[model samples]
Target chain A: MTDIALRGVDGLKVDYLALVRRRRLYSALLLVLFVALIAGGFDLADSRNAGGFWSGLSQIFDFPVELVREAINKGAALPGNLWRYLPAMIETINIAAVSTLLGAVLAVFLSLLSTRGLARWPRLMPLFRRVMDTMRAIPEIVIALVLIFVLGGGPVPAMIAIAFHTAGALGKLFSEVNENADLKPIEGLSSVGASWFQRMWLGVLPQVMPNYLSYALLRFEINVRASAILGFVGAGGIGAELRVAISWGTGRYDAAAAIFLLLFLTIVAIDQLSSHVRNRLVGGH
Target chain B: MTTLDAGFDLAAAKRDAERRAFRKRMLTFGIPAAVLAYLVYVAIAFDIAGLAARARMDNARILLADMVSHKVHVTRDNRFDKTTVAIEGENKGTYADDQWPAWVVREGASTVVALEAGNVVRFDPDAVRFDIPDYGVLEIVQNRTGITMTMPAGATPEWINASSSRVTVTRPEGRLTVTKTRAEVFRYFGGWELFFFTLDSPFHGKDWAQLAALAVSGERVRAGESNLAAMASDVWNNAMWRHKDVAWAIFETVLMAFLGTMGAAILAVPLAFAAAKNFAPAFPVRFGMRRVFDFLRGVDGLIWTIILSRAFGPGPLTGSLAILFTDTGTFGKLFSEALENVDRKQIDGLRSTGANVVQRNRFGVIPQLAPVIVSQVLYYLESNMRSATVIGAIVGGGIGLLLTQAIQTQKDWEEVTYYIVLTLMMVSATDMLSGWLRSKLIGGR
Candidate 1:
């Protein structure tokens, strides 16, 4: 019996070592392959690019340096330029805000109608889900550009485009939250003769409201960035102003600098604020 | 006396519940009201009321029409009295002398277009004539001075507009225009013209069955090349659409996303370790790394694209670098949080086995964090595909450049629609791909 046990122990040790060696070999192979892929892809991209990577590497800082030097030279005019662009910046924020609100409202209805167990019309749930999928699939720029052609370029076009996308994204998230919500309150509300709207409003919404708010805040952060980008594409905001300033070239970079400063500061401020609020809402800390 | 106190307590509790219910009711109504008030302000600020006047419904009509239809222009240059037929009036789509569409034919010196519903238009040497199905004959005579038009007898239809310098006749079947310099007729077609193959290609008019047969046969459509190869090369190098360039552009877009996302993830892991409180053990180092990440993120992609494009001179490289710069910050922040949240017990267990710091992290921490890292990276891969498109536009690199150029041309609505559809498909594909990977790697929740 003792000899058999010793042999079994020795066999176990050998097997364990072999397993470790195999894992190491596999991981080493994966690492090598990954490195090779990165190198090869970089070469391909460099060859295809208008400028080679090595040649452009040193010049990467030249533009920023020039921008900084010009801004410093025109320091006295910076504040005035920033002030001048405040309205456009406001338009950017308003576009984000309006779209978020409109999208969240729409998502509330769509998510409720599409959530698996809680769907009002279970038979049509797949159709609503597909509708959201299609909406989400389309890039905001496509819709924005189309609307710009039809409605002409403005904040409204950007707002509508972003809202359309936001509805799809938030609807998916909101339904996820809804699926995890406790159904007991809903059932109790319904048994007491509450209508469908009342059951959802008084029961399911309260449970999911915090998470919904958290996701909405995050969406707001993303939408702010999106709105700015759409503006650059001619939706009308600081982006348009930045485009104009940049196109004016050498002497007008100070305006461009001011816009950049505004955009950076706004993004940072919103990021910090939303992260704080989200932590409080979701983490309960 | 005790019972009375109990009753009083119950009453107080009841009053408290009523107050709480009242607050909830107010909140339910108050939030949406505030939202409504804000929207009203936005409507005023955005000038929604004036949008109607600013909108170009005519542009919409043209865009919708162009998306699904093509027009064949049968143009007669009166200066030289030379006639040509082209699709969409593009020189690339011009038909050869003998390759004109079956609906158009030349009889003697006149070119006759058989428009839909028996409407016929003839472009003759000194005159243009249109016979509408219901309306009487409309004729125009062009001289060196100007155009002379004789409208159909009786009241002229609203669709037909005539002047001394120009005359245009419009019907559901086709359109006719007469000017001193030229006379043209446009016949509408239901589908995209020359989408798969241009008129110049020998394979242009072949049906699918014929193409399939030719593809397998030993015959060579062009000398020194197989029929299949020649057909493919023709489509790829198509002058009208530039399919080869478009395919390259899409490839560039994907390359940008892949390189940027993977590069960011790689660079982020070490920086994340430096930022994580449990790993760095130095306040200043952690704080500095965190701030660096914040700075990278705060400088949005648009600004980065501009700065990078100026340095790199407009290409996929600039777009890729822009994404890399922005995503490094996001990934760093997320990775550090995941590191901080790692199960300390696992590290302790590894330590009991005499594992070093590196091994402890490798076996203990990473095993716990791998799921998160993989899922987050894949999610970004999908979203970065989208960002790459927008970045591509700003940097003048990929399909976004093609799309923007098409839209800017204002007359390439068909091309714009094509790009939009392709972009949608690409994004949806990435979304599905990432979701599949996430489910496979992390186990679906």
Candidate 2:
């Protein structure tokens, strides 16, 4: 009996060792494949690029250093430049704010329509979800450029583009939040013969409002950056101004530096503010 | 207790509750009212009323028309006395001498184009004639003394714009324009023209079944390759749509997102350890790392893209590095948060098993953090693909460059539409792919 037990234990040990060995081998192989992909991709990119990666690495700090040196030399103009660009900065912020507001409003209906168990038309939930998916899939720049062609260069194109994207993004997130909401209130409202709008407004809205706001706040932060970028492509904001200033090159480094400072500070301040509010909305409440 | 005092206290409490409810109701109305007022102010500030005047409905119409339909241009160059038929009036789409659409036929020195709705345009040697079904034939003659146009005798129709040197006739099916230098007729056709193979390709205008048969046969469409390879090369290298270049651009964009997201995640893990409260080696180190992350995050991707493009001279690498720099900060902050929230009992268990710091992290902490790390990384990877396109535009690379170029050309709206569709597909595909990978790896549904 002791000999039989010993042989069985020995066989089990061999099998366990082989399994461990195979798992390790597979992991190593995956690691090697991953490394190869990265290395190969990098090599191909470097070859196809106008400037090789290694060669470009040394020159990476040149532009920043020059900008700084020029700005410091013309430090007196910095404050004046900042003052000049303030309106443009406001325009950028306005684009973000308006888009966020419009997007959140649209998202409320879209999310409610798409959420399972709470959809006004449950049979068409997939349709609404697919529409949201397609909308979300489109890059903002594409829509912005297309609208710019029709609308001409202005804030409207950027606003519409960003809002379009924001609605889709927030709709998906808000629907997820809706899924977590307790349905008893909705059912009670339905039992009381409340209309669809009233049911959603009275029962569902209160529960999901905080999360929606938090997500919208985060989206607002992202949109601010998007608005600035859109301006670079000629949507009329600080980014457009920045593009012009930078294109002027050496002599306008002071102006560029001032704009950069403004953008950086604005982004950081908004980040801190929105993040604090979002934390309170999500966590504290 | 006295009955009167108890009743007074109950009434006061009821009054307080009613007032609070009234205040809450007022707030609900006030908030929306404030929002509406702000929107009104914004509308005025943005000059909403003036938008109508600023908008170009003609451009919108052209864009809408061009996206789903193409125009074939038949031109008679009066200067050279030569006629040409081309798709979208592009030189790359000019047909060879032997090739011409059935609707257009060359007779003697004149090229005749048959249009829908029984309209026909004839480009004779030095004069053009448009034969309308309902109206009599309109003629225009071009010579050294300039041009003259003659329409139906009764009254020139509204669709025909006639002047001494220029004549333009617009119809639902086609348009005829006669200028001193050139007389051209554009026939509208549904669908994108020369999408697969250009006029120069031997496989141009072949249907799918025929092409498939040719592919399977032992025949060679070109000197050294099978029909299949020849057809593929022709389509890929097509000068009009540039399929090969477009495919490469898309690949580069995805590659940028891949490299950036992975690189950032790799760089952030160690820094996250330093920044995390429980995992920090020292207080000042954690503080410094946190500040570094803040600086990186505050600079924003736009600034990083600009700086990197200036350095790297506009390519996928610059866009990738910009994404990497921005995401490093994001990943650092997020990963540190996740690390701080990790269950400590597992680490203690590993320590009890005589595991050191490395083993403790590898065996205990990693298992706790893997789900968050994987999910966040994958989510960002999907989002960064969209960001890469925007960054590509600024940095002069990828599909964004092609898209902007197409749009800026003002005549390539079809190409713009194609790029937009491709970008949407790319984004959706990445979203699906990342979601699938996340679920597969992290066991999240």
**DockQ of each model against the real complex?**
0.72, 0.76
i-RMSD values for every candidate model: 1.1, 1.0
Query: Can you give the TM-score per candidate against the true fold?
Result: 0.94, 0.94
Give the alpha carbon lDDT tens digit for every residue of B1-85 in model 2.
5456644687778999999999999999999999999899889878889999999987998899989999999988877878889
Q: Alpha-carbon error at A88 in model 1, in Å?
A: 0.7
lDDT of 2: 0.90
Tens digits of per-residue lDDT, candidate 1, B186-264, equal 8888778788899888998889999999999957879999898898898899887788888888888888998999999
Scored on chain A only, each candidate's TM-score is 0.92, 0.96
Best by DockQ: 2
Highest lDDT, which number? 2
Cα lDDT, model 2, residue B219: 70
Which runs of model 1 end up more than 4 angstroms from their true locations? A1-8, A248-251, B1-22, B136-170, B177-180
DockQ of 2: 0.76
Q: Candidate 1: lDDT of B205? A: 84
What would the per-residue lDDT of candidate 1 be over residues A1-285, giving only the tens digit for each residue?
Answer: 666587787887887899999999999999999999878877887787788788788988887787889999999999999999999999999999999989998999999999987889999999999988887777788788889888988899999999999999899999999999999999899899998899899999989999999999999999999999989987989888888888733347888889999999999999999999999999993
Over the full model, what C-alpha lDDT does candidate 1 score relative to the true structure?
0.88
Worst 10 residues of 2 chain A by lDDT: A244-253
The CAPRI classification for model 1 reads as medium
